[model samples]
Target chain A: DAMVIQNPRYQVTQFGKPVTLSCSQTLNHNVMYWYQQKSSQAPKLLFHYYDKDFNNEADTPDNFQSRRPNTSFCFLDIRSPGLGDAAMYLCATSRFGGEEQYFGPGTRLTVT
Target chain B: SQQGEEDPQALSIQEGENATMNCSYKTSINNLQWYRQNSGRGLVHLILIRSNEREKHSGRLRVTLDTSKKSSSLLITASRAADTASYFCATESDFGNEKLTFGTGTRLTIIP
Candidate 1:
């Protein structure tokens, strides 16, 4: 099945240490997105790549960065992990324009 | 806030009952969509309704959009235990950027 995949379903990192989460898709969708989701809350958009053009949400912290090295792969790098940053990181993909999105199983990050 | 709000933050219903969740947004949207997320899992796309369309259905799921009121509703018929999850409504704005603003999700529990 063509779907999105995320590596390290559970990640543990020390405080102030940098952590990288990976996402890849076989769907070959033109748009890739990263979102942060805390317990009992909605997934918050962090940034997205629309065919190499990165669009970051205004409220996204500088510590959060994303890279789409190619069409199928995207990475989320946390410059400095914080306790509050411990949450599920979700990756999604969709075609251009207003369309439905397909999401990966998500990476659960734990900052110690 | 660009994000939408879903009413009845949580719901509990018996199996075979119908479940309905409502969402309201503040801005003009090009399309509205509904998604389901299992506990500690990624979101699954349920249905999508364009602004020009009023209603859409897929199997047991039905979605209704009212662009004039900036609101949408998702109805799940003959709910099963497998349907227990958090449901969210997302909107694609008129900007056509495909940036979706998701509503506060509704957690549904189906008691078998």
Candidate 2:
């Protein structure tokens, strides 16, 4: 079945260390998004890629970055992990102008 | 920033009982969608109701939208223990943007 997949469901990183989370999809959607969800809070949109163009949310920290090497793969990079950054990172995709989005199993990041 | 707010942040119900959650948004939306997330997992798209549509149903799930009030409701009939999860409402603004603004989720617990 066509779906989105995220690698390393749980990740542990030390303070100030850099970590990368990966997401890939088989749905062939035109847009990919990355969201950060703190415990008991809404999933906050950090950034997204529409085809090859990157769009970042105004309040997203500069420490967070994303890359989409191809249609099927997108990566999130945290330059310096902080304890406050520990949370579930989710990846999602959808066709252009499509309201329904498909989400991957999220990656839980633990920053020590 | 979150665009939607779900009422009754947490709810508990017995199996076979119906569950209903309401959401209110702050902007004009092209569509409103509901999503489910099991603990420690990714979100699953449940339903989407467009601005021009007042209500829709799929399987045991029913969604209603009130554009004038900027609100929506999700009703799950005969819910089971497996339906225990967090429910979120996301809005797609009418600005032709691809981003989805999500609401703080409602945690529903179904008891067997």
Candidate 3:
């Protein structure tokens, strides 16, 4: 099936350490997004890439960053992991504007 | 601030019963969509209703949107145990942005 894929479904890192999560898609969508979801809360948009254009949310912390090397691959980098940052990070993709998004299984980050 | 808020934060029903979830948003939207998420997994797109459309259906799922009230409802008929999951409503704003604003989800549990 043509779907989004995320690597390392579960991740554990020490406080202040840097960690990176990866996402790839076979759907060939033009837009890819990263979201942070805490337990029992809605997924918060961190940033997204439309083709090669990167758009970050206004309230997103400086510790969060994203890179889209190509249409199929996108990466999220956390410069300094904090206890509060431990949550499920989701990746999603869509064809263009106002379209249905397909999501990956998500990566659960645990900061110790 | 979250754009969408789902009512009845949690619901439990029998396998053969019908489940209804409501979502209310605060902004003008180009479209509204419903998604399903299993425990510790990614979300699956269920249905999308455009701003010009009042109601839409896909198999056992029915979605109704009332732009005037800024609210939408999802009905799942003949629910099964396999339908136990969290349901979320997402809105694509009229701004024509590529990212979607997700609502606080409704956690539904179906007992067999």
Give per-residue lDDT, candidate 3, residue A40.
Answer: 88
Question: What TM-score against the true fold does each predicted structure earn?
Answer: 0.98, 0.98, 0.99
Every prediction: chain A TM-score: 0.98, 0.98, 0.98
Best by DockQ: 3
Model 3 agreement with the true structure over A1-112: per-residue lDDT tens digits: 9999999899999999999999999999999999999998889999999999999999999999999999999999999999999999999999995699999999999999
First chain of candidate 3, TM-score: 0.98
Supply fnat for every model shown: 0.88, 0.80, 0.98
- Show model 2 residue runs off by greater than 4 Å: none
- State the lDDT at B12 in candidate 1: 99
Any idea how many clashes model 2 has?
0
User: In model 3 chain B, which range of ten residues has the least summed lDDT?
Assistant: B92-101
Name the better of 1 and 3 by DockQ: 3
**How much is A20 displaced in model 1, in angstroms?**
0.4
Looking at model 1, the pairs that clash are none
**Per-residue error (Å), model 1, residue B1:** 1.6
User: What digit string (tens of lDDT, one per residue) describes model 1 on residues B23-108?
Assistant: 99998888889999999999999998989999999999988988888889999999999999999999999988768988999999
